[model samples]
Target: MTTLMTVLGIAVFAVGLLISIAWHELGHLSTAKLFGIRVPQYMVGFGPTVFSRKKGDTEYGVKAIPMGGYIRMIGMFPPGDDGRITARASSPFRSMIEDARSAAFEELQPGDEERLFYTRKPWKRVIVMFAGPFMNLVLAVLLFLGVLMGFGIRAQTTTVGSVSDCVISQSAASAGKTACGKGDPASPAKKAGLRAGDRITGFDGRPVTDWDTLQNDIRRTTGPATITVDRRGGDVTLNADLIRNQVAKSDGHGGYVDGQYVSAGFLGFTPAAGIVKQGFGDSVGQMGSMVHATVGSLVNLPERIPALWRSAFDGAPRQPDSPMGVVGAARVGGEVFSLDIPPEQRIATMLMLVAGFNLSLFLFNMLPLLPLDGGHIAGALWEAVKRNLARVFRRPDPGPFDVAKMMPVAYVVAGIFLSFTVLVLIADVVNPVKIT
Candidate 1:
């Protein structure tokens, strides 16, 4: 039964991935058709074609990349003097001034076939280019809404669950100085001192009603500080020595930075099962905030690098954090699925995750850099401005932008992609986030 469940999970994952890609591409196809742009080819994936069929004016094919797909519109690049498809010299379809006309879906069969992508207006072309990312955003929103409308979401409370003993080293509770003795030995904690079942009242005067709150205070003091625990009768103050231990800094999606660690004062406290649910609106807002915060971190990564680099690689002050790649992401996904919640709640959680992922893809692709929807949008706008100026000066419109010029951006994007691929490979080795 476990093996059967595994196969089913894999199958579902594959199907969902493909469906998302197709939906994204459909946005472009639909917009192109709406504007009378000839879409000669629509494909999903990146490598050799596994399946293909021709219908009406377009040939649809699936590639092996399994990551994403594209809608090929001819005439998207600048017109070259090399003369391929010309301006309606005699025919609108077979113009010689065309060699895959810029922003134009002009790639007809080697024989003589006609589809008109170049004739579309500038605004229309812009819409077509933007549609793919827009679709991804829409898909994410739908998934989020579906999940929330189905199984409800809740905010984690500061409530304690169970107390743990023989604490493992990591985070605050793991420090050598912080790990409490099996029983309350006459050690530093017992001396300075502390006892089991002591409800930590505060740290540095900050009220600590729960373990997490106490942790936050401990992590803030990496060296030494005072901890006040509310005993059965009164508050007992003791000095705590903080220690640093390697802990997984989760990147929302199960990805984490392993070797590096966060430090906190250990209290040998754990929790037992009991949680408080947040309001509906607050729950939704929390999810939104999570997505925004994570994406913001990724976007601001450029500024966070040098310091982070020195810490991780160079023996400089220390490293901030590094990114986890695909492997890390997958491990997180598996872990989330592994949680022993009801099937409906599990499904909702998974869908919520996919929705967040798609949202990131949509926003990231729209970043006006090269090799993205924003780049294409920029190209189209530039061409529009150039054409308008030419007309004002009594010269011919410059037509569409050149794709060759955009190759540099594409190369850079390719390099970025390759770097992430390496990260993914390394992530598998560093700390694979496992389910159960």
Candidate 2:
């Protein structure tokens, strides 16, 4: 039964992945055609085509490998200064440029002379290139909002789940000394007569509704403090002196890190969990935080390669924040389905995973580096800047930016990306990150 569920989860993720790829390519195809650029093919995958059909001027198809997708636009790069696709050259770098230039015009038809992508206005070209990643961002936002506002997310509530018998320092806890020793002091919650099932309504004199704010308030207060709770249809106030003690550090997301310790006022009680639906503002805020975190991850990606190598080849444990590929994500999806949780929660988690992946795709593709969509956008923008500056200086209008010249750099970037992807794949297979 577990195996079947795992297979089902993987199948579901595969479908979602295909949809995301097709959706991303559709953005490029639609925008290119709208801008009068001739797009010859819109493919949802790489390698040999499994199925394809010509529609109007474009051939739409799916390939065997569901890894990535692309749309082939005619004349993506302008011809050389001599007004023709230059012949193959002696140097490998020069050959790369010529090959790219030739491929861009390979589908040149009679009417395509004026319909080339490079012939479009720089702004239009920017839109054509930016559309793909923007679509992913839009999809990610919608998915996240659906899961957050529609399905609701599991959150901590004001109700107490359990009260500690004695206060245990985080250092002691991290050392595996969870049980209270004879010298341990009675916990504030236990001493103040706070019990499980007590729904705390206020801390000090301020009204407490959410666990995050309440936890922060608890950490900030020391000495005598007042806690009001709704106990059996009656409001009860308990008084206790909050003490400074070592505790687990906050993850900044209403959660505590297990092994990381910090000195703060200790609460010695666990908050109960409940499903909470977020409003539009809250949902948007959550997405903003997620985007910020994703950007940080991308910025730190280069530093993670060494860790990935160790995990893949040196038998090192995979770090929780290690880079994950499609394989790792799919494995996580399988585990999500197999977990002993409500069906809705499991589905919500899976959707969140897909949403996060889409978000990552948007940010990754937006990098201003060659071979990625953002590279073309950056090139177009640079061309626009150069032309505007020339106009201001009363200089001759420069021709379209020769993107073909950067083909060598694009190839180098592509090679690096491919190598990193393979390393991530190996790490994912040999030492996968498991959420249990």
Across 175-196, the per-residue lDDT of candidate 2 in tens digits comes to: 8897888999999989999999
Alpha-carbon local distance difference test for all models:
0.61, 0.91
Backbone clash total for model 2 is: 0
**Candidate 2, which segments miss by more than 4 Å at Cα?**
167-185, 204-206, 220-226, 232-252, 256-267
RMSD of each: 9.6, 2.6
Give the TM-scores of the predictions, in the order they appear.
0.61, 0.91
lDDT tens digits, residue span 61-160, model 1: 9998777788887555544556443443454333422422433434444432233444566677679878888888888877776665556564322333
